[model samples]
Target: MLEELYRQVQCPVLAQLEIGVTPCALVFLDAEASGSPNLRCGDAFSYVAQAVTLNRSLLNAGLPQLTIATNAIDLVDDYLSRLDAEIRPAVFPLRPSLDLAKETRFYGAHFKLDLLEQMALTLPANRLLLLLDTDVIAQHGLDPDLLRRCHASGVGAFDISDQEFSAYGSTRVIDDLELVAGRPLRNPRWFGGECLIVSAEFVGQLVPVARACFGRYRAVIPDLNHQGDEAFISAALNILSERGQAIIDIGAYRMVGRHWSGSTHRDLRWFRGCALLHLPGCKALLGRQANRRTFSSARLWRRLVLKHELNRLVWSLRLHVQSRRRDKAIADSPEAPSQTW
Candidate 1:
């Protein structure tokens, strides 16, 4: 199954810009596969704007940047060009496999995992790769020694062990995944997909396991609510760790998820000290920040925490009303399923 998946998903990189003088590099993924669901927060320009904001933040932090884009090469290239050539991210244009387009559940999130697998195979093994989401921003520069230490240890990712962020994982999800993998997880903790730091060698080892798990997950899709890459990748890491592989929880020191939406409102006091902030549910703020010549984090916070919540309330209410109307319409339809059980 793994070999077949590799053959189907693997494709040649059309072109790549070279990164200079950095053993560690950062790559942000913002791509939509051909014939795949368009699940970006906003239209094409919005998310690309977010990535532009993130790229500038990374360059400010002294990290060389790269972008792995599929199907939207011209758009990403234009945005990255806004940066000066010396620090602009090297854009690698990849063609997404048809298998990636078939996924309806995740809307091409898993496709990036396949893209990362290819990156692991193509890029130099000695250099470390930081796979960042477009929604995240770097708060501070990382020390050269710290980057070396993380790369030496193993894969770096955010650990969401606290029960507060139940959206990331649960006992039920782990139990189901363990049944699929046919192994019990020793450290059953959830890792967010927002920011992942990995070496090419480790990714080479991890992708096969994740691919196998995903292949098996197809049989139980109806039984599972969460089928994204985060769950499967977390399971794969746990399985590898049980086999003596090192998996570092960089959430403690490197990055933190700022949950300023939904029921999870994390304290912002700790965010100031973190090196990176994964600002999910705040794409509008990100786009606004990108247009500015200078950004103020304080204003970003006020708009995100206060104004965003009000906007979310209105958004949720509208969704609820739309859902209720849809339910009524379904009930009225002749083809609606009989409610009798």
Candidate 2:
């Protein structure tokens, strides 16, 4: 059998791999109230473990400079304190915990936006801030070229999944933005908030725009669910787009709500050339694993063992062939697909 991958999720520390240099800060907000369901599930340990895992991944990805925002620092304090004394200072608070529902016009979305807005005030216009969910696990640190492309585009999200308006006729999102901006702006694309890269130039307006749109959306929608943050981000990007600003979609191989949903051979999405793995809408480590128990008990998974084994052999052979072909091409020419990483 092939050896398991060099997955950051399993081991927090990685031998630093050489990636082209790109200076940027990776920020993660892991603030969860003590009463949160994740805490109730006794999953705090895993949450802290994932945070360390992600931190180590970033360090190896040529991005050792990390800024972490969390209110539950006590939960991860042990892990954080174990790092070099000099490194502990990077962990800070996500402040002004107002009626988050009132401040950012949404619950989870605006709290992050508010914090980001404040961070942008001091961040230089030349640098880029890659704001990500604390739950995101990176097998690869990040492709420097991917980040450069995202930075060049001004603003970028992990993927663009939402079309103009989803089923709910969620005009409230746009309406709130219009009320704040005092003008109409078009929201064309839906973004995945699991991860976003913002250039200093656009941060100033993006945060305020998302805040304004969400704040008044409460009165307009009246019964809005504190669900996806992408809706708020989409509004802000729409306004930016109207004024000739652009946001790029840094597509990934696949995204799944339940982390283990695509863990088998039937889910071809897992085998693609994915850049990262994201559990965007997840609120807890236990939640990402919820599918594991069910998947393990599935009749198909049990009955199709032989078929799955054959699929694995075929997939492995294809990868081997591709690698050999690329290696041969590299021997013949300086520029080849081998540099894709």
Q: Kindly list the per-residue Cα lDDT of model 2 for residues 141-167, writing each as its tens digit.
A: 555545555566667664443322442
The TM-score values for the models, in the order shown, are: 0.71, 0.58
lDDT of 1 by residue, 1-341 (tens): 97745644562121121222121222324444222122354355566667667776777766566464555677667776775565455666666552533444555556666666766666564466677766777767764444554567657778875642454346776776575565787667667777777777788788888877767666666676566667677777778878888777777775555555543344455666677787766767786777776656566667666765676677678768978998999999999988876
Q: In every candidate, how many clashes are there? A: 0, 1
Tell me the spans in candidate 2 whose CA falls farther than 4 Å from its real position: 1-46, 72-79, 82-89, 101-109, 122-125, 162-187, 225-228, 252-260, 263-272, 280-341
Candidate 2 weakest lDDT stretch, 10 residues:
17-26
Q: Which residue pairs collide, candidate 1?
A: none
TM-score of 1: 0.71
Q: How high is the CA lDDT of each candidate model?
A: 0.63, 0.49
lDDT value, residue 43 of candidate 2: 49
